[model samples]
Target: MKPTIIRPQGLPDSVSSPVVTPIMPSVVYASDTPDALDAQYEGRTSGYTYAREGHPNADVLARRIDALEGATGGIVTGSGMAAVTAALLGLCKAGDHVLGGDQLYGRSLRMMRDDLPRLGIETTLADPTDAASMEAALRETTRLVLIEVVSNPTLRLADLDGIAALCKARDILLVVDNTFTTPRAIKPFEQGADVVLHSVTKLLAGHSDVTLGWVAAKDPDLQRQLYDFIVTTGLTPSPFDCWLAERGLVSFDLRFDRAQRTAETLGRWLAGQAGVTRVLYPTRDDHPDRARAQALLRGTGGNMLSFEIEGGRAAANAFAAAAEGVAFAPTLGDVGTTLSHPASSSHRGLTPEARAAIGISEGFFRVSVGLEDPEALQDTFGAGLAAARGAR
Candidate 1:
């Protein structure tokens, strides 16, 4: 008999060879034969031909998102806006009408209201929390309805089930941005959402190192179309970033759970504070849609919360300075707790009237709670509150 094998029993097989998924940075791939290459290009075989079309790393990340979002199929893109652009332009054509929630992300609103119109696709905005408002805004040509599970900056929870039902009855495709209320909180597809979107740069990545996005469709055909659009438009994300994001996803559950706990604690403490006029957290009793949030999110308030200062923008600035250790970053979803001013960062594109209409005022402070000690965060917040009061 031959000498005993030195390697492990399963190591020889490629499938079980490595515990960590490898990062494939190849811009181009080679096949065993010409016929195999043709088959790969024609979708007759499972393989990669070029990075622009697809890559193993991206596919790995996309499949993870599919599993998380409970989607039939999915694809990764360069950025959050790229995913939005591909989904809109690929599925809806000229003369097609789209209805968007008035409280959607700032860039998304700008795209629908300003950019899509130039492409002959028109959009209408309505209060996403009210199904009646959405129904009233729909046109005969309405093909899509877009809404966020939880609105940004202010963290308002939408009536996802109601809106999904409305879209289903009308045969309109319901696309939901699940960036805020990640898969850990709720699955929109179960509520009749046809498509789900994620800004992977935020909570999904958890580290704030990668800028990426993904689109998942309940319909396989729609997913194929979106993938084709992404490939043709070169909206594919970098393979390395996809690898990094995949690593981040490994710790997503732990991060999200910790953030959720801290957010709830902070929201309650802020509400009891003197300088805070209003605190908006989905799980809070005073939240406008607390009941809805409870039902949809399973009593879990997400990590994001916003509060208003007794003073306006000036007080907000003073609070930021007093809240030491909390970085005043314009972005969100990092492992470290951070603060963002929506009026200047996420909602800067909107007019002052539009911003005020959505209640995103100068003094509003949105916090993306991170894995920090609850008492420590409260101490910083207490100092910030005192500063705000003095500033006013």
Candidate 2:
């Protein structure tokens, strides 16, 4: 029997619509016209005359992400940092000020602290968990308020609705990094965020094979502005990378669901174990923002969890070295569980004082759970804990 090719309706068999499939080279120039060629040759218009500006695959991924986030539209970028930089630069000008959350991604912290200020854009970091503190930090020149739906190493959940309301009242754009809580788990736009960003390298892609980023916004104008900046600045994702991301999205729901369940089980098990000083999972009872997290996040608390060891840096390093089955790596949101020592890896650029300010202690370890059996994962940690404690 000849193979039957099943293509998504309204999309060519070569390309996935809702999710992009690989396209054949033969189809690349199928739609090119003499007029289009002339326009490209003449550098005529702002429309997609080249893939650098826009491509069908990237556009589809953007639309799918926008639908998932319940936003007007979205733009895909080459990397998470590109998405963040594009969003921040597109929204604010030289004289503008940005009010950002305290527990941001380390690279984002660097951008805000080092780069933006050099360009005359000032920033103030606030603890979004403390609404009073966030309010107090806002200034008259503030043009944007940025927060992560869930922070990188700490797993701290920001008050999205509260921050959105604050930004709305102050006429500032509310930019949220929704990397930890992918659209499968939470939609920040639905919760009142003006713009939602994602490190598609993480949960959104799920496979850890691609590096892509996205920004979803409620206002069409805002979306257009961001898209324009991204294209003009040449920070857009390649067609191939966009296709990989789209394929990843097809399995995002199932992957995240399984990972979240494993995370919850591990979080509870770790909380009960000896030599574990603290477990910071959003669903845990002792979490400071548990109530707010429950109120805002729709599905599971997510796969990322952070814990501090009883014996500080030495113990943490020992546990990380002794851990079996899971990979002790810097990046997160992969099919295989990976661990990060933020004080040294992600947040290394920050001063010791800055790291301490965000509760990222020397003993802390951030775990990104994967789709592995809960019992196997638990036993691995149990052995690692024993080894770590013995070393002390």
Candidate 3:
């Protein structure tokens, strides 16, 4: 059911309608009879009986995200990590095996490598930059193949369609982390992904305030199972957070479009700037996976780019400290430009060898371009470059 759209006061009751939905933080809903409440509990009825099981606010946000992904259903979790944990547990048993990309978010990699093992699931990691690495990692016991659509920090593109086709032939589920590329940028379901997950704290939420994660799937059984897991594990988000996320969706498209444009501008600018060794944005011709990125991604390669500052970590720190208008947050996808050092932040948990394998060197820094003016970004980065080149 659609949320009621209220008309504003004194506008002839026709010209204005509320563009936002009200927050529903109630933990329980009324039921006429025990039978009705039982039916709701058993998923036979439509109303929400309990917040942990299901909340009206979360349901609205889930439906919104699923609609964006062209999915059958979606669920909002307490965090993106919760979404991953719930989805994986919902799909696999104790003995099930899984495969994934080598370059993943540190926490996710740990979950697949450390936590899942303690829970009796096995996982193998390999470079997902090409189909060969993915093919080599597959096992007879593999139940799911997980990959990042674009790798963290490095911004490398995965052969999404290629891996998806392989998973189909093997009858294994394919899951893609769509955080870097939101549904507005790419629909993984259309590319053969069985499931898509996002840390809505990033692009979907737009602002840097809320912490949310969501999972979307085009399969009825998987969706039901995921919902059950969320409810049982108490990973569902609070109504207030879900409500704020729903509001964020109101301007998601515009934010994504502007961010993508700004990223492209910065990618090009960084490529020619002094003290910049290389840019790893997927849209660049020099990128090894540019062709694959073109085949899989829509619009530009997204609003993320990782560059090698000529002067190493010290220079990277100088750049961030010297840039006037930019903020150096440990996170990304905010409306304002932010910088992060993967070696110290996002990929800090990985070993030196592991980080090197993913193209994260001592000088590497990832920049998330925001909706700020292109010229302003140029000047900010220019100061950063001056620091790196020892001119400042």
Candidate 4:
């Protein structure tokens, strides 16, 4: 998700504390003296020499996110996957074992399963919701443990406290993907995560207009390690994207509150709908991990939820066609409501049997709730349910 380098406007001599964050797009900064340049390079002074190395916009966003996540320090990356890769590369060496939740985001699971192995880092997938299972999967060489605060598509909650405690006792770094449950709902650092990762492309950006991510480390040394990896690999995000993401953060709390409220309303409505067989929402009493959700999350279930339409792919497609205002977009965390079919989108890479084993049935549709009026949105979903029934 490399962005096109947009030439920035001419630099001003200085702006006296502009209300808005100014996007500094210069790829390189000039130093007044060789001593100063060496000082910056040696980390004896704070400065930006290259965009790939550091930039004011990224530094601002990183600081903001670090505060939000209660992290000791942080770094921004070009994308979510890049953040994951950077964290793993910084922390693990060849022969080190990385244990990740089986239900992590598809690409993340792929990186651990298929990609990291190539680098001589071994990865094991375990049930993140079950602390005992995670303990059983750990090996003497295990160096990192990864889990999503909430499983993708299914809305399953992970036992973060338990998992974090397990990792702490064993001296393994615990990485939690806070993409689904953004800091608005829960901060992984408070729950004992060594590193917190986000797809700023999602909720943190809110508008679905940016491709960026960040890694927040609980330790300063760990943050430097991740930062060095990002800079060395040229994985820093463009200044423009970082600026947009910062702007998005301005309304993140408000947008997330509204969307999550509507998600609760929609979840209740869908549970009683004609064609919906089951609904997966953290706030729902019947959710598989309700107890954990109650203990770990704020009162709200996140803005994301999934439901099983009566028919498989056919009903799902028919529902999408009839869900008037809702776009059948594969992505999530937009300001507008959109539907994603995991069978055909997020989890499509998995074999049919593999998906089924994880409860991602052909009929499942994950919804990224938005700021739409709840009643009207329910009406829209009602119409889609009728169409789904007809298709069945």
Give the winner by lDDT: 2 or 4: 4
Q: Kindly report the root-mean-square deviation of model 3 from the true structure over all alpha carbons.
A: 5.5
- lDDT against true structure, model 1: 0.89
Stretches of model 3 off by over 4 angstroms after superposition: 1-19, 42-44
Could you arrange the candidates by lDDT from highest to lowest? 4, 1, 3, 2
Candidate 3 TM-score versus the reference: 0.92
lDDT of 3 at 155: 82
**Residue range 1-392, candidate 3, lDDT tens digits:** 97866633222456666577768787866788999988876879778777888788888898898888887668899999998887788899988998989888878888988988999999999888788889988889999988898898888888887898899999999999999878776898888999899999898987888899999767888888888888899997988888888888889999988888888888898899877888888888999888878877854688888889776677877887788888877888788889888888888887888788778887898888889999998988898788777832
Q: lDDT winner among the candidates? A: 4
RMSD of 2: 5.7
In the order shown, the candidates' Cα RMSDs to the true structure are 4.8, 5.7, 5.5, 4.5
In order, the Cα lDDT scores of the candidates are 0.89, 0.83, 0.85, 0.89
Off by over 4 Å in 1: 1-16
In model 4, which residue pairs have backbone atoms overlapping below 3 Å? none
Worst 10 residues of 1 by lDDT: 7-16
TM-score of each: 0.94, 0.89, 0.92, 0.95
TM-score of 2: 0.89
